[model samples]
Target: MTTALPSGLASAGLNAGEQELLDRVGQVARACAERADHYDRTARFPADDFDDLFAAGLNAPTVPREHGGLGLGPLSRDTLTLWLVTKELAKADLSLGRCWEGHANALVLVDALGSAEQKRRWFDGVVTRGEKWVGWSGEPQAPKPGEKRRFGTSVVRDDGAWVVTGTKVFATSATGAQWAILLVDTEGPGGARHAPDGRDSLLMLACDLSDPSVSVDDSWWDPIGMRATVSHLVRFDGTRLPDANVIGAPGAYLREGWQTAFIPHYAASFLGAAEAAYEYALKYVIRQDKVADPYVQHRVGSMAVDVESAYLWLRHVATLWDTGKREEARLAGSRARHVVEHLALRTVDNCVRVCGARSLIRPSPVERILRDLTFYVRHDNDDQVLATIGRALLGQEHDASFYKP
Candidate 1:
């Protein structure tokens, strides 16, 4: 079930080894595609998909180049390769792609800002032990009325360790993750202490999820789609983490700019799901002998345009990152995310319309893909993203090359 990527989508500067790696992932995608529905129905973690990825040597994309890893390029240095890998995984299963993306994102943070020992330990866990990682940054606001909305999670120093208390929601891949990268306020028991350097109080800590005080509440994650992601609520009840577990300095997570580079990873997943929907629609039409009908032809043709547009946006964003256009890449990525969001939604909607009601039935590939795309694309507010783009243009001048076509 491996589909050939359209000719225009080919990447440049890939070594023979990288190309072979991609080919191996194609086989893994097939295995994941076969098991996607069962996992979705049971709302279980796609452990098999991850096993396949690990066995194929894809579990650690940021291991230092000297250690035989893909390096930080997956985040910024090597975005095109990361884009292709993520898109391919998502083409088979968006939930799996999402979880893997989080794993890789955490690794990039370590690579960029972690101490040498931290990098050695975390990267070894992933590349050697086959450990899985997850990120949990969002927390539900405190429920007390008249309280300002803010992060409820906080960590404090205690006996040479950091004790964490509070709950994190949307803990993607929480079911079986061996490690977690948590965002917490460094304010101590006094309640509101700021960083000594006057930076943001928000800090990231890498902790073992096996800590006895840590627990995952799986009941809260029954959602409209992406059910297999198992992004449940995680609570840390005075969870003790070693002082050595602290990652980077306070605010380093945001200061490093990897977050902007990670935006296109989401865009890649969205485009992949849309591409899957498009493929299903094509097969449906061919099977029904309706490929010659004018209505079907028009719908397919329009979907082609949207898919192609998404491809171009991804390429531009990846190119911007590759060329070290950091500021331009940030802005382009912001706009590209929204652009791909709309294009993906339209592509799926049109696929469903063209395929008719039968495609909505169980076991139809389009059925699950439509649900996954619809749920996952709502990760951000389109209005807020657009406003950020507008404000950037209003406040600054840009070179003409930044906005060409």
Candidate 2:
């Protein structure tokens, strides 16, 4: 059954390359949605979906031709292309959307940070024959010296190489990935505002997961939603990295400016989830005889407005990002992602309310959405962000200017 989107999408033209990529991505999405139920039911990983994704070079969107990509292809900056594409994929299957999100993060790291030589070597591996999926593994201490591992694990230099120790939890697909873009503390000694660990830290290192030091534990994620993510614990017991594997500058990963660009790529994942709910809910509610009642129509009507409002907000965020409004982008990026992620849950809640018990039935797409959206809605810093945004608006110390470049 064809799923109707919650509202109308404006007619827009995609130049040749843009349209082509979107068209091809759509086919993959169709296949993924087709298999979402079975995968969710058995808790099976979406291995086949990824195989197809790699074939399409979706894993390395920004890798240049020299390193094996479509070579800095044009993704429409105005529209929510990533969101739209991801939503389609999520509508078909959220697991695959998730798997690709991690891959996309690695690709962004490689494209933006990898050294020329690193690009030549690793990006080639990804493009020529599709390299293994990459994971993150750096967890520097929170500045106050009391916080446990937060980001990447540890960065210890050994024999002109880096030996990293620490595990990065919430690794989405560790069991299947071949490589990982790790975060490490290269500045072994120093202190700064964000560098509370006295480790002038943060390095994006490429790691070969085969090293004996790295171990992938059994999948332990039993969540209220998104049950098939295969998200599990990864322990790096002093995993070592070659000097050449360092992808970016020593301190670039967590730098203030980095969030502006890097976070949007992930934001699309939530937008996709929200869009998927919007897309699927339309078809779902319409087919249900129960929702035809007046009170139910009121609920569905609100969902439609929320979905459209959310999309416009997303596009505005993307526009700010493309136009180099970095500070605004950062704030909007946070807000956009927050709205997208939360709206997704709201949309799903509407689905459950409108569709009733059918949404709870096993193997149903609505149930899968409940799982996926719930996971995204749990992202950190909502109250703090809102307080900061409010303070800035009130001409207090933490104004928008505080985030402005």
Candidate 3:
């Protein structure tokens, strides 16, 4: 028998079209889960899984209908549906879900900030052609030994074209992505070498990853879990693009609050990973005839509670976004992220504890799930997120400003 969705998610607020999309996502997720082990074992990119997603019309749901997409507009009830889709996918395969989230984030930005021509180009390449898209924004390298550390990749205007030069670590799904929306600084050769306000000059560049100037370094991505994601280091050396390739104005990427709008997606993905571990433990315990033990029951009960709480928190964050409670939604997103992160970690731990040492061996789904969940929840700015929440709660600063990128 097919498992029933949680009560909270069974009746989640979704329109007819959104429900249809969720069903499609669920189908693809199940298929992805069936092959997740092989992909993990080989540490290879799940290209076939993405092909299944694309064939199911699940590649670019956030693009507007006018641009040939599912037209799930920003900050709408559809956002909740999208979160459900990501959660289901993550439950099946966290690495694929990570790549999907990046794709969704890219579409969100394109829909919000792209000009008419830019949107048409992106829609044709991604939505129509079924090409995969990813986002690369994280950077921790400096251009020179003495220069102040650069905050992001750099782009310089050169002879009517833009030359992007920098290296980005953790370029999730970089190996498979056909296009990337890169965060760049345009203030100077390498973005205001020592300026105090250089961070505010961030810009978004939509680059074709097939360009010769782009190179992928896969040597740095040997992780404990989510190994299939292939989030390697990527270098852009004199990667030239026309001025039209720039997606938004300088600082537009941050000013639009896109990051805050999509925070629930991340929470949903992590929650799904935890749920996967919990379900694995449930099945293992039942098969081993240990479900009747009081200790086993207690652990299972706690896992269920944690999973449900995380789902509810994700729903709350989605509701806040839908209701136009922008500031409150931002603050709530941060709080929910922290809560879900803790709950997910605990849920995985409980699952491992209940299942015992045998579950930690090879060919055991629980072991892999635990590793994936542990690595996935280590998102940046954990302590800073809590500090921001504290500041907002104490009225020391405006809540919305705390989530500015």
Candidate 4:
């Protein structure tokens, strides 16, 4: 029997064409799930899965309608559809969902902050040429105390072109991607700001990864879970980019809302993996004729509750975003992810207990899903997020923003 999503997750206000598109995504997701184990075992890029996504036009769903794309909005009812899409992909393969989310995020950032020409170029690259892209925001912290944290990758102007240098850690899906939306520090050795008043010095650039100066170091990415993401360390040494590659003014990337908006995607991913584990455990119990056992039913009941809670959190997030309560949405997303993180851990543990030792062995979908989720849920600093939410409750100074760009 085919595994179905938990009750009430079937639709998200999608029209006929959009619903058809979602069905296509479901087909692609199942295909990816079939190969997810191979990619994770080898720690390699799932090129076949990405090829399927690109061929199905899933790569540019958020690009504006005028740009010849699906035109899903970031803060509309479409947000629900995006959540469902991410959850469906993640249910099949967490790593694939991560990379695809990054690709979709890059497109959203480019459309939101890129110039008209930049939008035309980047959106066309995805919609027409089927070029894969990744967004890199990870940066090394400042080495010394009392130093303000900034993007370690520094870009400087030389003879009307921009030269970029620095390393980005955990650059997921960098292997197959041809383009990157990078957040870099513009104040190079000369300490010059792109704008007056010394504000907004952080620059966001659309870079071509095919540049000889850009190198991807795969040696650093051996992790316990989410291995199929291929999130290797990417280094850019003296890479030159054109003036047109600059996205909006310095710091526009952060000011634009993608940072806060992306939290629910993480929640959706964790929730999906947890739900998958639940389904696996449920089926295992049935197959073993253990459904009549009270202990098995108790564990199943516990997992069911957690899964239902996660779904409600995700739906609330979508509703908040649709109503233009962005700040509330961000906070809700943080709380949702924090709670879902623990819920996933608990659900997966219950699955292991229910399925017994045999399911832990290789080639079992449950085993791979367990490992993938074990690592994927450690995203964003949970402690800090909780403290921030606490501060908000106390009416103290707190920032709802997850990323500072």
In candidate 1, how many Å is residue 97 off? 0.9
Off by over 4 Å in 4: 1-6, 12-15, 73-77, 142-151, 187-199, 403-405
Candidate 4 lDDT tens digits, 1-405: 333446445564557876887798899999998998899888988889888888887867678878877776473347777777888888888898888788877787787777888888788888888888877876645444764434357777898888988777678888978998877767542111122233467677788999899999888678998888898878889999888888888766545545667777788888878888898898888889888788887888889888878887888888888888877887888898889888888898999988899989877788888888878876677787788789878998665555221
RMSD in angstroms between candidate 3 and the native structure over all alpha carbons:
3.6
Query: Per-residue error at 75 for model 1, in Å?
Result: 5.3
Clashes of 1: 2
Task: Report the lDDT of model 3 for residue 201.
Answer: 76
Superposed by TM-score, candidate 4 places the C-alpha of residue 232 at a distance from the truth, in angstroms, of: 0.7
Q: What TM-score, to 2 decimals, does candidate 2 have? A: 0.83
Model 2 residue 362 distance off true place after TM-score fit, in angstroms: 1.3
After superposition, the stretches of candidate 1 with alpha carbons farther than 4 Å from their true spots are 1-8, 12-15, 72-76, 142-151, 187-199, 396-405
RMSD per model, one decimal: 4.9, 4.7, 3.6, 4.2
Where model 2 places Cα greater than 4 Å from the true spot, the runs are 1-13, 42-44, 70-79, 135-152, 186-199, 290-292, 391-405
Each model's total of backbone clashes: 2, 13, 0, 0
Q: Give one digit per residue, the lDDT tens place, for model 3 in 273-392.
A: 888888888888888988779999898888888988888897787777777777778778888888998898888899889999988897777777788878887754567678878777
Please, what are the lDDT tens digits per residue for candidate 2 over residues 43-105? 667777877878776656556655556543122233355555655576677777776666655
